[model samples]
Target: MLAHARQLLDGSVPLPAGTARVAAAMLIRRALEELAAEWSGCPEATTRSQLVIAARRLPPTEAERACLAWFALSEACHHHAYRLPPNPVELVRWLSVVGGLPAPHP
Candidate 1:
């Protein structure tokens, strides 16, 4: 699911507005589903929170930034309790995926 999300993010598959967020929500939902199936009992609140955060951090293309910013802001308003992921590796990957980083990994 994450791989599919990545593909969509990378433009391998075109996604319309709300598609990325929906995809991410579905992936996290499935993870929670698997945990519930095993009686592992995932924290729905925390997972939902993180997925929201990830969706917000998604980069917008230059042409789409204005529209995406509005969408992102609306999503933020509803999910105000969510916290962004803090792990360094995850942060780096998120920035890279969002096109906030330089090319070729120099």
Candidate 2:
């Protein structure tokens, strides 16, 4: 998913607002899913809300926690069809927070 997100962000051409929105959503969603799965061993489907709750349990930095909170409430991509595409820079920051999370134990 991150790879696909990267492809969408390649900037080979100007991305449509809808395309950018989907890309941002996909990247963040995948990141949240992974974090949730790592937090809980269930490994089944999980919602963004659930992921955010799970994230709070981890020993995350304040910025990471805030980023997760933003992901939980931000509607940047939720209404892509109705609203403007999210800022690429902000999306990248969210992705960075995800990337910064500690790896799961072996």
Per-residue lDDT tens digits of candidate 2, residues 1-105? 655565576665368856765666667766656666766555764555555655566665743564453564256656645666766776666666666666656
The Cα error of candidate 2 at residue 34, in Å, is 2.1
Worst 10 residues of 2 by lDDT: 64-73
Please give the distance, in angstroms, between residue 95's alpha carbon in candidate 1 and its true position after superposition. 13
Q: What is the lDDT of candidate 1?
A: 0.38
lDDT of the structure predicted as candidate 2 = 0.60
**All models: lDDT?**
0.38, 0.60
Residue 49 displacement in candidate 2 (angstroms): 6.5
Q: Judge candidate 1 at residue 42 and give its lDDT.
A: 31
